[model samples]
Target chain A: MIRIQGLRKFFGRQPVLRGVDLDVATGEIMIVIGRSGGGKSVLLKHMLGLLRPDAGAVVVDGTDITKLRGAALEAVRRRYGVVFQGGALFDSMSVFDNVAFPLREKTALGAGDIAQRVEEKLAQVGLVDMGHKNPAEISGGMRKRVAIARALVTEPEIVFFDEPTTGLDPILVNTIHHLIQDLHRTFRFTAVMVSHEIPEIFEIADRVAMLHEGVIIETGDARGIQNSTNPIVQQFIHGAVEGAHHVA
Target chain B: MTDWSAGRETWPLPARWVEALGEGTLYLVESIGRFGRFLGQAVALVFIPPLKFRRLAGRVYFVGFKSLTIVILTGAFTGMALGLQVFLTLQRVGSEAFVGPAVGIALVRELGPVLTAVFVTGLAGSALTAELGIMRITEQIDAFMVMALNPMRYLVVPAILAGIITFPMLTAIFDVAGIYGGYLVAVMLLGTSPGTYFGQMQAFADMTDVMVGFWKSLCFGGLVPWVCTYKGFHCGHGAEGVSRATTEAVVLSCVLILIFNYFLGSVLP
Candidate 1:
């Protein structure tokens, strides 16, 4: 569903993504794992067309998003749903309003129809009857669920989760992961998630790609990645303190 | 950007200074270009179809109605102060009756719009900037973008439209309140004849003066939101970034209003 070829990005003198090449198949949950600040988010932004790459093309479905601009790019982006790391809920809005925002703004759907869809998504995320509450009034876990419900309300063809379970408690992390897995099974949208929840990610991801120093070091199924011989991948998945993955 | 200081002993001071001057000039030009484009986009979007009436109405309530009290109170006090000072000076020259014309002209042509703009900038403009800055920092803006929504259309157009609609109306109110304030001080507090005060003010303050204030207020209304929204939309990283953007938005907006007022004052009839 997505193809990125020879992608390159630079931040001043420091290079973030140096010719990264990857492809994600349709209806697959591809989780990209990397150490903190290892350009994982940068790579994700490039794919979302939020940041233009210095070189290379990002082909989503069949269109080269890099060449699209303004309304054309926006038209393509309508098919995407993004769950930001912090949930990024509009604080001024109630949870229901937040979820209904996309439908109200983009679709010609009646308010009744929008409400029905929002309520359905909210229930799927286990957030029933929580619509009246504001995002600030909810717990961290509930806020994440609200974000998910908001993203899914539009029934997008693809969903990008930027560390959806980050900053959550262990049990909540598992809950969110399970929720994502369950939703993926039902929606069957192409998923590209940037996360670091090693063992847990292995359970959910159809395929795992390990990023190191601006390149994909390895891409394989959960068992294949676990049994890989790449020292860098081994050190990262094992959380080794000292190994081929240098600290400094 | 080569480090001239690395070879300071060999590099001439004049050359270094020239390079720094060139860089500063380029930076200023770039900043002006960016601001001009942002303003153009914002203004153009305000006229686009599917005008966000709901958002605009909410912003008008926040920017216009909420600011009414401060605008009126400040206008009244400024007029009173001007009236008292002018009356005292004219008393020495046996021309205290002309204090009405002086205060009336000042408020209608200058003070009304200028003070109103500054007050609105301090109140609504700062809040708009901080709100947008927070949205940018928290990735809400990014969320909007990924949802195929135009943040400029949803957020900026309403603010600019609100400013354009509110500033002049508020200035007109300010001028009326200020004129009454002058009457309270000169005709009631002091001993100036009421007929003379009203007559001289009516004769001196024409529609031209009133229009000048109106135009100035209209221009200021657009300027505040233009500068403020740009700052917030392009604001830096976190809480500290939002704080800095808010400060810069207020200071830049107030300064621009004053500067624009001077030019408008000099050129307008």
Candidate 2:
């Protein structure tokens, strides 16, 4: 569903993404695992047309989103929903309003229909009775679930999760991961997630891709990645402090 | 490639000064151009269809109605001060009746619009900058983009429209309160004849003066939101960045209000 080729980005003279090339198949969960701050989110943003690459192309389906502008880019984006690392819920809105926002702004659906849809999404995320509460009033895990509900409310064909479980506790992480897997099974939308939840991500991801420095170093099925001989991948999967990739 | 700036420390002091001046000039010019572009985009999107009336009404409440108490209080105090000062000066010259005209002309022509704008810049403008800056830093804006919503239309156009509509209204309120304040001080306290005071004010302060104030208020209304929204939209990351953006928005708005005030004063009449 998405193809990124020769993606290179730099911050001034400092290179962040250096010639990355990867592909994600439709209706599959593609989880990108990498060291902290290794430009995983940057790659996801390129796919969403949120950030234009310094060089290369992010082609979604057939169109190179990198070159698209204004209405064209916006039309391409209509098929996407993104869950930012911090949930990024509008603080001024209640949970119900946050989920209802996309539908309210984009659709011609009646008020009763919009409310029904928003309530259904809230139920899917297991926050059925928490609609009236503000994001600040909810716990962090609940907030993440609210964000997921908001992202999926539009029933987007493609969804991007940028470290959705970064700060959650281990048990909550498992629950959220399972929640995501169940949703994917039900919705069958193509997903590209950037995560640090190593083993947890491995269990859910159909294909695992490891990013190092700036490029995708390895890409394969979850078992193929586990059994692969790549030293960097092995070291990362095992959580080794000193390995093929430097820590500092 | 030659790196001319690499050894700049070895250059003469005058050369360094010249380079610094050139860099400052370039930065200022670039900022002006960028702000002009932002202003253009804001204006273009403001009247587009599917206008979000709820958002516009919310902003009006914030940018206009919320600032009412401060505007009224400030207006009253300013008029009283002006009246007291003018009355004492005219009393010495046996021209106390002229206090009403002097105070009326000053408030309607200069003080009303200028002070109201500065106050709104500090109150509404800074709040807007902070709100937008936080939204930008938190990736809420990115969410808007991915959802196919135009952030400019969602966030900025309403603010600009609310500003344009409310500034004149608020300025008018300020003028009325100020005139009443002057009446209390000059007529009630100083014992000037009420007829002479109002009669002279009506004759001296014409519709042209009122129009001048109206135009100035309109320009200031647009300027405050333009600068504030731009600053917030492009603010740097984190809490410190949001704070800095808010401060810059207020400061820049006030300065521009004063500058526009002087320019319009000279050009309008």
Candidate 3:
């Protein structure tokens, strides 16, 4: 459902995504694992049209999102939900309002209907009673769930998780993983996740893409990622200090 | 609201005025530079490669409609107060008849324009800065670019257009209310002839004076939001940084309106 070809992006003079390419099919959860500052999040932003590639195209379900503009692009964006890292909830709005934002902004849903859908999505994220609370008032786990509920409020065809479990505790991380698995099974939507927690990868990924030095060196099924002979993959998965995946 | 001990005030007599004038002048220059940038983008929107009219209209409504209630409220109360204060001060001379010309001239030539602009700067200016600052620190502006939308067209142009359309109307409301407040003070409190009061207003009030005030007000309206949004968009850091930018926006807008009033008034005979 997503195709990115020869994607290149840079922040000022530093080249981030250097000619990367990848594709994922419908109803599959594709996890991208890489070290910090390795262009994983940059790659995700490019796919969402939240950041443009310096060269090439990011096609979501056949539309070249890099070419879409203004309301048209916003319309395209409404097709997918995004769970931003740190759960970038609006501080001024309540949890219910935060989840209802995309629906309110992008759709013509009446107040009662929006309230109903927001309640249902909040329940799915196990945040039933927390809707009245502000984002700062909630726990990190609950905040992440609020973010998830907000993302799903639009009933998007695809979802992007930008390091969903990065700041959570181990127990909350498992909760998020189970939630991801359950949602993937329940919603049957494509999931493009950026993560580094190795064990969590085994539980949630249908396929894994390994990004190294601004390139995707390996792309394989869940089991393929585990047994691959590529030295970079071995060093990374085993937490080894000496290998093709060098420190610094 | 009137706490004298919130923070220490160390400014001496001569130094205080100097700081006020200096800070006011510095903000005027900075505000002009930012306003230039906004005008450049807004003007370019007229001839740009791709024009987004609907998005631009939405932004205009944001700048104009959302700010309506505040502008009107400030105008009404300010007019009433100016009317009462100026009449009482002039009552000692027993030339209370001059109250008509005094109120009309102040409202039409200087006070009305300057006060409304300052009020808007405090109201719309701060909001603009905070809104854009949050968007900047959060990378929403970057997100717009990623979506291949020009931030200039989608954001700045509409605000400028709205200010142009809204400020003149607000100033007119200010002028009418201010003069009426003066009448209430003159006829009711000081027992002046209503006929002579209004007749003097009609005689002294020139089209030139009213026209210049409205024109200057429109210019201030555009300048305030333009500078506020520009500063916010280019701000550094997160919440604290955004908050500082907002404070500066409000302070600078008030200063610039006064500065613009002097220059624009100088040009008006």
* Candidate 1: docking tier: medium
Error of 3 at A5 (Å): 1.6
- Name the docking class for model 2: medium
Second chain TM-score, each model: 0.93, 0.93, 0.81
Give the alpha-carbon lDDT of every model.
Answer: 0.92, 0.92, 0.80
- Ranking 2 against 3 by lDDT, winner: 2
Worst 10 residues of 2 chain B by lDDT: B1-10
DockQ (Cα-based) for each candidate: 0.59, 0.60, 0.08
| lDDT by residue (tens digit), candidate 2, A31-67 | 9998898999888888988888889999889999999
Candidate 1 lDDT, tens digit per residue, B57-101?
A: 999999999999999999899889988999999999999989999
Per-model TM-score, in order, reads 0.95, 0.95, 0.70
True-vs-predicted CA distance for residue B131, candidate 1, Å: 0.2
How many backbone clashes are present in model 2? 0
Worst 10 residues of 2 chain A by lDDT: A8-17
DockQ, candidate 3, comes to: 0.08
Ten-residue region with minimum lDDT total, candidate 3 chain A: A98-107
With a 3 Å backbone cut-off (N, CA, C), the pairs that clash in candidate 3 are none
Which runs in model 2 stand beyond 4 Å of their true positions? Answer: B1-29
Single out the weakest 10-residue window by summed lDDT for candidate 3 chain B: B1-10
